[model samples]
Target: MVSSTSEPTVVRVSQKGQATIPKGLREKFGIETPGEVFVYEDEGRIVVEPVPSPDELHGIHAEGHERGEATERLRELRDEEKRREAKRAERLRPSEDE
Candidate 1:
């Protein structure tokens, strides 16, 4: 993989001390919204990480759990369990099968 570097970009902080990360960096880091987390190095090379709020965590979980219907949920869970059991049985089977 090619190592890509970003051009120097200036970000201005408002009186409220809020700064917008550059669009290029945002796209590069997959940061689309306010709740996303990020880590960056400062001039001293100190790593700083932004923590997401409880609401953000809850929202992400909610979006993941929204599979439309309960039947779909059960079906997916059952399918996953079946795959797990098959893998376990395969592992437990004799090496002669190979």
Candidate 2:
């Protein structure tokens, strides 16, 4: 498995394809009530990640950055992450010369 936490957890999916996240897992991931979680598939595996709501992220920049500035900063951070991921993939992929 790509990642492991204790043992595998079996969650029941309803007819609507909705599955409940285990409380322990939710708490460990900082999932909060009335919040949202990022769901996606990666490397043939399903991933569910906790994402801070806009309300939660408000005023995150303790250095007194304004709301608009903070939003731009968050966008910059996301773009930075994407660039880092691209670099990692480039390094891992086989070179054409190979």
Specify the highest-TM-score model's number: 2
**Model 1 per-residue lDDT tens digits across residues 1-98:** 43332334467989997787766555554555765554454344423233434543454445556555444643465456457546865766779846
Taken over the whole model, the C-alpha lDDT of each candidate is 0.53, 0.68
- Tens-place lDDT per residue, model 2, 1-98, is 24443345799999999999877777666788767876777567565766756776776766776657756765565556457556866877899999
TM-score of every candidate:
0.36, 0.51
> What's the lDDT for residue 98 in model 1?
66
Lowest summed lDDT window (length 10), candidate 1:
43-52
Off by over 4 Å in 2: 1-5, 53-98
State the weakest 10-residue window (summed lDDT) of model 2: 1-10
